[model samples]
Target: MKRSLDGFPKIEVNTQRKEGKALKKEFFRKERDLLGEEAIPENAYWGVHSKRARDNFPFSKKVPPSLVKAYFAVKWACARANLEVGLLEAKIGNAILKACEEGMEGKFNEEVIVPIFQGGAGTSLNMNINEIIANRALEILGYSKGNYQKINPFDHVNLSQSTNDTFMTAVKVATLWQLDELEKEIINLQETLQQKEKEFASVLKVGRTELQDAVPITLGMEFGAFAEAIARDRWRLWKSRERIKEVNLGGTAVGTGLNAHPEYIARAIVHLNEITGLPLAKAMNLFENTQNLDVFSEVSGLLRSLAVNLRKIANDLRLLSMGPRAGISEISLPALQEGSSIMPGKVNPVMCEYIEGIAIDVMGKDQAIAFSCSSGQLELNHLGPFIAAHILEMIEELKLGINAFTEKCLRGIRANQERCNELLEKSFALATCIVPYLGHERTSELVQECLREGKNFRDFLIEQKIFSEEELKNILNPLEISRPGIPGFGKVEVKRP
Candidate 1:
């Protein structure tokens, strides 16, 4: 033994002493009894999650922070629900609340690096939080760690609760929060598109390839379509909110509400509503809620549909803004970063590409959710953990998609007026609009003459003297012809030559 400069005792061991080996032996003996019990091994620590889960589900990356946040939200709600329902004493509720407040303030999330995939149906996750909360509460009560003497993880901290109920409740509460974020971002994107529509209302484009001055369409209509699509998604999200409200909070162990008081169920829901300020309601059938994850599946389906719609929009935007020189340049996307390494002037739709990737990720998560939901067996749904994990992931990705689309894509997108005008001027598709006014037979003759002579519609009309320049101009005006009040063949007086 030696003393350091600070006077603390230090034992300097030679190789012969084997001090490390002696310490390891002592520690192993102490931990042996703890490891004997299978339900909760005594030697377990907070950060040590199951490695097998990580190996099994390599498809999903580590669980997202949003999912962890949702976990906390659900725990808080559960504690509040327990208090409101009188499942726990007021003292225990107060202690749990104080512990939760502390837990929320602390860096407890550092322990959630474990794989979300587990054969125990999230029992490990439930225990992980339970142990953490119990330890924190013990500290709050001035008790030593691992002392079941003061606040037990099961009897006190997790009284009248089961992993089945708590996990599902957490999923709903977390999803509601995530959906709120998504709604705000989507609405912002919608508003941005609407403003663009109004700004470009009068900008017109004609059919260009046909070299026919086809009927006119304002840039506003294009942007307006984008706005309408997002608006519909917003409504769908709003409508789906109520479905998440039906939580199975009291269905402990398995939807039987066993070991729980009837009062506890009602109080839990009421308190949860108060704590979250959300309109959460008790499930009409706890058994169904636990056994059938159809609701989660349904919501996941809606999310899939949303992702598909988002991808479609992104694809259209990318196509419309394909090139400044070569492709169909109907719009100019906001150039965020350099698009190409070799092509000097190339500016790819990076935002759209990002959104497309997000959409793909969301779709993949949706499949995971569906698979997890389907894997549930009798009495209790074992896939609860995976469901929560994937759904939360979907929400986060969608949020990023909405934000990126708004900031990088929608904000930077501009109507390529010159390109649009050129394309419209060249397109012969406008021939259809004029056919309704010129009579089908005459329109056919005009189209044949233009095609045979490789001449423009205006040039051919002028050479044939089909009508005076003034009449041809009036008939070919895209804006007037495309308008609602435009006269048809019966209304317009035409002299047949």
Candidate 2:
């Protein structure tokens, strides 16, 4: 083995490969398992199980980076418990602990390569980590990478754990942290929208029902509604964490705890919670915990609700800021980039479109998670890898989309006050303000008569002396009509002769 100043064999790989050329590696180390023996790269940290998985499931999908980090946290905690319970030898246990601590910090994420969706109910993925840690533990103890004789991947690193319990525990831990990140971003978006609500508090615009003008509304009200919907989503999402708090890590394969020591089982979860600082609990009904994945469905439902609100709000923004000339240009989003190639000076609401795209994609991921959750077998939910992949992807995409929507689009939006006033000027919905002065039946009849005559309702109000010009202007003031109570009810009394 090649030696470095650290006294352990130098761990380095040659990666300069041309299109048709092979990776120029200088040495190889042989390692074997139940399947067979194989020559692994001398300096590479991964071992035979990882190599076999690489060849078998030839997909670009690696375990989600977050899940890798979380998986190693599970390993680290289990190893600690095993050491305390006299299962792991002292020196080797310390080496394994150091390796796992590094893994938890994401030092060896590149080694956790496997298809995000794979067979063996995630055993291949679990072994990949075990192999990496075992090799690294060997290297740490002044031995070569493939010298599993010094510290074995299965017998030492995975001492009291099974793929079923460990993988799902990692998924839950990773999801808890992912939820924390996403919740912070949601809070950012909610606060920003609230600020915009205050900024546009009095900018009046036409309120639409089914895309038809129905009443007067302030632009602030629109933003307020968006903020409120996100607030509800934030609460629901925060509450949804309760569903995944219970983890079944101590229950080995099939929830039987068949190979795990009772002392290891009791203390492992405690160490795990200490390492992760999450509200983790061992499953009371181990079988249910192993086989039931409906918690994913519940959380996905909450995520879908948020996606729906995001889609609706973003689409509304797209429509509200549609055009600077011909469309409903009542507001202007930040002009991010050139919207068209052939057309000159055409700026579209691409940010809103981007957010809408993310929302739609997240909705689809939620559906995929639903199906994956339902694919569980009798003793264990074999689809955790698939479910976890989509959940992590959805969370990352949502965080990115929400952050973009907040800074690039939502914060930079400006209410076109003049355009808002112009829209209400030609409107008939302003006639609703007169309903408090005139009874509903009389106002409805008069509105129908004006529509039939193709005459302006405000002009007719003045011509018929139902109201003076000043009185009509005051009664139909966009700002006044948009506020609570009847516009000009007490102030402008009808001058009836």
Report the Cα RMSD per candidate: 5.8, 3.4
Residues 1-497 of candidate 1: C-alpha lDDT, one tens digit per residue: 44433332333333334565543311110111233412222223341223233435556455555556555555666677677766667776677677666555545766554566665767666666666676566656655445554666677766778888877787788789888998899889889989998887767665332533545677777678888988888888889888888988888988888987777777777767766678898888888887787777878888888888788889878877877778888888877788789989777888888888999988998888888888888877788877877788888889887897888778877887888767755656556656656677888888887888887666576687765566655655545654676534443456544
**Backbone collisions counted per model:** 16, 0
Query: How far off is residue 417 in model 2, in Å?
Result: 0.6
lDDT of 2 by residue, 1-497 (tens): 56544443433456777757777655666677888878777767898898888788876677888899899889989999999999999999999999999998889988877788777778888999999899889878887787766788889998888998998989999999999999999999999999999999878778889999887778988999999999999999999888788888888887889899999999999999999888788888776898898998888888889999999999999899877889899999999999899999988888889989999998999999898888888898777888888888888899899999899999899999999888875577767777777777778887888888877777777777777888877775656765677777777885322
Give per-model TM-scores.
Answer: 0.84, 0.92
- lDDT: worst 10-residue window of model 2: 3-12
Error of 1 at 424 (Å): 1.4
Question: In candidate 2, which residue ranges exceed 4 Å CA deviation?
Answer: 1-25, 448-456, 468-484, 494-497
Q: What lDDT does each candidate get?
A: 0.70, 0.85
**Cα distance off (Å), candidate 1, residue 405:** 1.4
Question: lDDT, candidate 2, residue 177?
Answer: 91
